[model samples]
Target: MRVLAAMSGGVDSAVAAARAHAAGHDVTGVHLALARNPQTFRTGARGCCTLEDSRDARRAADVIGIPFYVWDMAEQFKADVVDDFVAEYAAGRTPNPCLRCNEKIKFEAVLDRAVALGFDAVVTGHHARLGADGLLRRSVDEGKDQSYVLAVLTREQLDRAVFPLGDSTKARVREEAAERGLAVADKPDSHDICFISDGDTQGFLQRQLGDAPGDIVDGRTGERLGSHNGAYGFTVGQRKGLDLRVPAADGRPRYVLSITPVTNTVTVGPREDLEVGVVTASKVIWHGESTSVECDVQLRAHGEVYPATVTIEGDTLTARLTSPARGVAAGQAIVAYQRSADGDIVLGSATITASAPLATARA
Candidate 1:
């Protein structure tokens, strides 16, 4: 099989490319240039798709003895992932940029191009598995598992996806990179939002959407607690940076409960208000032929899994969790998984539209 290894200048991707080559696949390393003018700071995971990252990926390909190329996908990426992220935030929703990148760019755009160019599959360094049965499953390294983000991949996309590091731990991956004499063996892993390399999400959004001043009111009392430059700066269950002066009746700190973009308002309340047991989602995509299924629901990347009973009808998905979840936000993913003898199988995912309290939903 001919594989296009999506190298990101990290230890995991380097080893993944090396392993794909060792497996006798005709592998070619390709680093995605996501930014027009890349940031090449040696300042420890400053940015993904940096000029330095592309160089490191090329060096890894040299070590692995595979053909390497840098593909410029910056224009498409900015329009799809980055612009969508700003729009979602402006609509007062907490969007996961990484998930969007995987959904729109990596699997959809890259895989489409790979297939068109006669590559059998696009191999990536994501810590998730695609089994021989064509089911997407959790990786062996649970701590480093990335199934939550990859759940957005459709069945057809999963068929052409290869995750070479799914079976190996990150420790073993780094060791393999060192053995292969890859320069990125000791490089720090990128954890921040790649595009928002400065880590000022609020600042970035303000630049894009401009300042829309709004009142931060109490959810229960509807009393203005404070004011914010933009409602998009806050997320459900966020506590700090609120700069609120209101003291709760229980003398506890307040958390963001909701955001009304139409009204330019952010609502705050006690932490208990954040509890939700039922999630209604839209834009649902299932991996298999089943229209409905029972599975555990994962709300965020690397977050706790909650037992859930999921049912789907067209684009509507309803997930009833056994327990309450905190900080359930709109525009976040609700990934469904089934525990079988084979392991945790990623059944499908949807975009959370709304949530209700455990007691309220059951009532």
Candidate 2:
């Protein structure tokens, strides 16, 4: 079978490509230039899709004795991932751009094009496994598991997805890269949102959304507490960088309880206000059958997996948390995981539409 390896100029991808070739697959390497204007070369660990990254990918293909090429996916990336990210935040929700990339660009855009061109599958370095049953499962190395992001993929996409590094640990991947004479064996992993040239998300959003003066108010009371240049620059559960001098009467630190984009209001209150008892997940995609079941729901990328009873209705899934979850923000993903003898299986994922207080608390 012919394989198109998505090389990301890192040890994981380089090794993944190498392993694919070693596994007797007819493999070709391609590096996606995702930035609108990629630098001549990558400087530090903050940037992705640098010209240097492209060169590194080509070199890896040479080392692995495979053909290499660069694909310009910048416009598609901006429209699908970056623009969606800004829009979600503008609507008073937190969005994960990486998951968007996996859903829209990597799987949909790349895989569709690959299949059209007669490639059997699109190989990636994501640390998730596509089992013999065609279900997506967690990787052997839990610390580096990336099933959450890839969980958004449908059953058809998983059919043509190949993850060569699912079983290998990151440490062993680096060792293999060094042993294979690949230069990116020690390259630092990219952190935060790759598109953000600077790590400041607020600064990035401010530049795109522009200034709109708004009130930052206490969530409990309607009293105004402070002001902001733009409400789109804030997210729920944010504790610091508020730039407000006001203090609570009890002298306790405040956290962002909610962001109302319609009124351009940022609501602040005590930490307990961030607790969420129920999550309504929209745009749900479940690869499994049963409409209602018990599973582990993970909110953020690195957040704890909590027990949840998820019920699917039409196009959405509403989950009742066994224990309240804090900082449950809208626009983030809620990935469902079912326990299995092999590992935790990715049932599906959804975009969080809203979270409400527990029924018990109201009662």
Candidate 3:
């Protein structure tokens, strides 16, 4: 089988590419140059788009004895993932860029190009399982499972995807890389937003969307509490850094309840106001069965799962949580799964459009 291995200059991707070669598949490694100018992005282990990362990927491919090439995906990545991320936030919603990257850039664009070039599959180091039954499942290493981000993929897109490091833990993969003479074996894992190397997301958004001064209002009293540089800086359930002038009458911390981008107003209230019992989403994609099922829905990446009753109709999906989920935000994905004796099977996923409080949901 001919495979295209995506080498991200990280230990996981390098090891995944090497393992593919060891499996005797005719493998060619390709590094995506996501940053138009590498100098603008962070260097070292902090970012995947740096010049250092591309060189590391090339070195790994050379050691693995596979043909290597770098694909210039900066324009596509910017238009699809980066621009969309800024737009989502500007629209007063929290978006997961990783999921967008997987759906639009990696699986869609890269996979399409691979198949056109006669490659059988595009393999990556994603920590998620693609079962023999063609269903996506959680990795055995739960701590590193990335199924939530990858869940946005369509069934057909998932068919051409290959995850070589799904069953292996990060520790084991690092050990294997060391044995294979891979230099990135001991490299620290990338954290935070890859594009925002300094880890200042608020600063990053300010740079992208610019400052749109807004009012922070108390949700209960409808009184203005403070002023913010931008409403895009806040998300649902953000507590710290509010800088409100007035203290709450109850003397409790106030969390951001919602953001209205058009009005440029951010509403803050008690933490209990963040709880939601119903999550309604759009642009649903089903990988396995498409029936209305009693399942578990994961709202955020690496977040806790909630038992839900999921009903799918057309392109819409609605999940009613058995227990209220705090901080349910719009534009994030709600991935549904079925807990089976075999494993937690990914049923489908959708982009959250709105969430209803327990009382409103029941009514």
- Show model 3 residue runs off by greater than 4 Å: 39-43
Q: Where is model 1 more than 4 Å wrong at Cα?
A: 38-42
Residue-wise C-alpha lDDT for candidate 1, range 1-363, written one tens digit per residue: 999999988888889899999999999999999985656455677667888888888999999999999889999999999999999999889999999999999999999999999999999999999888999999999999999999988888988999988888888888888888888899988887888868898999999999899899999888888899999899998999999877777889999999999999999998888999999999887885676666799998888899988999889999988899999999999999989786799989999989998898789
User: Tens digit of lDDT per residue, candidate 3, span 1-363?
Assistant: 899999999999999898889899999999999988866545467768888888889999999999999999999999998899899999999999999999999999999999999999999999989999989999989999999999998888888888888899999999999999999999888777777778898999999989899899999899999999999999998999999999899899999999998899999999999999999999988865656889999999999999989998888899999999999899999999998776799999999999999988788
* Candidate 1 residue pairs in backbone clash: none
The CA root-mean-square deviation of candidate 3, after full C-alpha superposition on the true structure, stands at 1.1
TM-score of each model, in listed order: 0.97, 0.97, 0.98
The alpha-carbon lDDT assigned to residue 114 of candidate 1 equals 94
